[model samples]
Target: MLIMANNFFKPVGSKIFIINFYTFSKIENLIVWVNRSRYKNLDKIKYPAKAVIIDFSKCKPNIKPYHITPLACIIHEYQSKGYVIKLKNIPNNIECYLSSFNFQQFTENGSMIDIPVSSDCKILPLWLIKRNTYNLYPNRAKEYFENNHFDGLSLWPLSISLAELMNNIFDHSDSPIPGYTFTQYNATQDSIITCVCDFGVGIPVKVNNYLQTNNRGKLTNTGALLKAFEMNFSTKSQPHNKGYGLDNIISNIKLLNSKALIISNNVVYRIFPDNIEYTSELTVNFPGSLFVIWLNVNNLSVKEEEFADEAPL
Candidate 1:
């Protein structure tokens, strides 16, 4: 079966493909076509299917992290859905790589993916955890820092980001820890990545609900996400509250020359170094939100400090 490139690259798709992933309707299973020579175009495979068919017949040279990360994420998505995945027309080089990777479903016995995560990427061990209160998260995430070997300076912004994320889950999401959080540092790439995923009310719904309660006009998912980065913008109504949480995350990214990708509903928003920005609305929607944070660790200049009082939230 031929999947047309034009089918995937709409206006929003050309800029940000993740938006298109959620918009694909009634996607019970996703069939992925990978052109090994054009590996960078994996973003075209935007939605999740009950089963994923990876036609890697064209791939000859083998794959790298850029390929691995998306492939792994897709594999994880499929496994989480208890779906069957098959890779066909693969070359010997790719097969050997998958063997060495110990990737499940590709092995001789069709086992599970067992790539040396600690080596390919620094990862958080806590894949799944529950949370009703805010206090437990940071403590539970201590393992993430310790295992990933993060420095105080690098940990600072992450600490604040996680807190606000937890608080958001508490205040608005009305959903606890039905989320997946991955924190990893790639030594060779000189970058640190933290991706947290949640299944909840999603950003658009939460934002519109608040607006409706306040008798304001309705805002689309794109507007709500754009507002999220604004300083003091919030949905919470509380005493002496200043919603600087999202703004704080944005600031730290600027201070450290980092990048951020925020996805909710059908919208995808990204902030890159030098203040580059990209936003797109999807046809489909992810229930809650996902935050992918990328920081240049070597360029970091934040001074390490001892917390005299407590955590940043």
Candidate 2:
């Protein structure tokens, strides 16, 4: 079906024709009737400079119909670029599918893809743990808290903790060597626990090398992990190392009110709410380091409570 504009007085003037596969005989009749009366002059109709074509023959039968508002906006944008658009061959099945599904139904029933989570509740391989990339973990956590009708503050600490852990994995680990593995699980009744394990050279070995050069001699990995938190104790000398990354992590642990355990070179440095303790027994079977963090998701109060009574005095 074609709707054409004719200008008899100026045959060479601009003309517009709108064509469609479906017939609009009644609409055409109405237009003819109007033309015979008020629109007797062909110049009365304003013609748009551009046209747009939408083809749907290759679209799936189950696919929803395309919305026209965005298409209209696109046409307006292209008109500014001095180009005309023509929409052609729209599939009948697409229209039918769209008509069958309402906006609410589409929003509610759409498939949400699954995201990978660890058994320890920590997302492994920080590179793979993105907010929107996999199941929207950040927003999902927010929505969960919202649905439970809790204050908004419960989710922010955990989010910051996760970001810090992931950032450490990326920045501290020496690449070219296979990186660390991350895992998470729920612990006790109110805590979410996560662990990051790296098989590369352990923290103790790095620290020992640094100390040895400074004439402090060889130190054990357990000693290294503990000393790693000491302000200004860094592997890089002079202006090369600011020695603040690990120290900052230790400081933030208090701010976040979290617990962490580092096992390296057969030694464990466990930091609880109050006391920081060290043990010589190396639980790690490999040459890398393992950091396990426990977050209290239920009661996320930044205020320092009395150190847990269980911490070694």
Candidate 3:
């Protein structure tokens, strides 16, 4: 449970500890781990240091977009603060997943990990995208899935959604950190999941800020997040920024009877065919935005003209 480090000659020396969260690897688990009393009291490892090792060997292998986005974002936040985060005892599949995206390149003492030859699922490796490169997402994403033989109709909506979501990162996040995007297709389940994450001022913060600046009453974090999805709702004042991106994403996903999850700060807004759900019960400590969409490959089709002129690919 405890790993030791030595600088025996110095009066004050650094220590190293292995962090093992003895629970299912959920985003909330990572949140609680990282946010627990400077990250010391959570594991009760006693000695605190600038560097730490996270042991993911015992974690479940069923990692999802929702989990990976927050995990990567949290690590990015820590690294930005000069913390040395090291990964150890990673499950092979998880290691391959992280390695496929060049994830280790950004971590301390991390190296390139080879993916297994037996892997069958298709992956669009996680990308760190900035304003200059965001426009490439839609086209690149389209090519990736199209080349992989996904249905054209399904991809149209996905492409449009990606364009809007990617644009939102640079236009709205207002953070220097590049946004993260990833996609994975599970052939066995006939489903695809794509996610976008950014460590910028969250949607709620931006909405409340716009409200305050305009001399309007502020809404709760959850309320502000809901207001964000309303058609024509936006914090941007530009004439062409129509604020239809989130609304359009919801609309497209509904057409396919798919699902989308949006998280800003502590609030979670879920869009599904049956109903809309919003909650603050999840212990998400992220200060930016995370969006994820799930669609079944078999359930995708385009109603003629809905996405005709907007198909960039």
Best by lDDT: 3
Off by over 4 Å in 1: 1-121, 132-154, 174-177, 237-243, 302-313
**TM-score for all predictions?**
0.58, 0.43, 0.75
In candidate 3, stretches whose alpha carbon ends up further than 4 angstroms from where it belongs are 1-14, 17-27, 34-52, 78-85, 96-102, 105-121, 151-154, 237-243, 275-284, 302-313
Query: Which window of 10 residues has the lowest lDDT sum in candidate 2?
Result: 64-73
lDDT of 1 by residue, 156-237 (tens): 6666776666566556664433454555566777776766665567777888888889999898779877776778878883
Rank ordering of all candidates by TM-score, starting from the highest: 3, 1, 2
Evaluation by TM-score, superior candidate among 1 and 2: 1
lDDT value, residue 165 of candidate 2: 42
The models' CA-based lDDT, in order, is 0.55, 0.43, 0.66
Supply candidate 2's per-residue lDDT for 212. 81
lDDT at position 303, candidate 1: 47
Compared with the true structure, model 2 gives a TM-score of 0.43
What is the lDDT, from 0 to 100, of the residue 144 in candidate 1?
54
Best by TM-score: 3
Tens digits of lDDT, candidate 3, 81-140: 566888888878878876765556646422121221113337776565654566776777
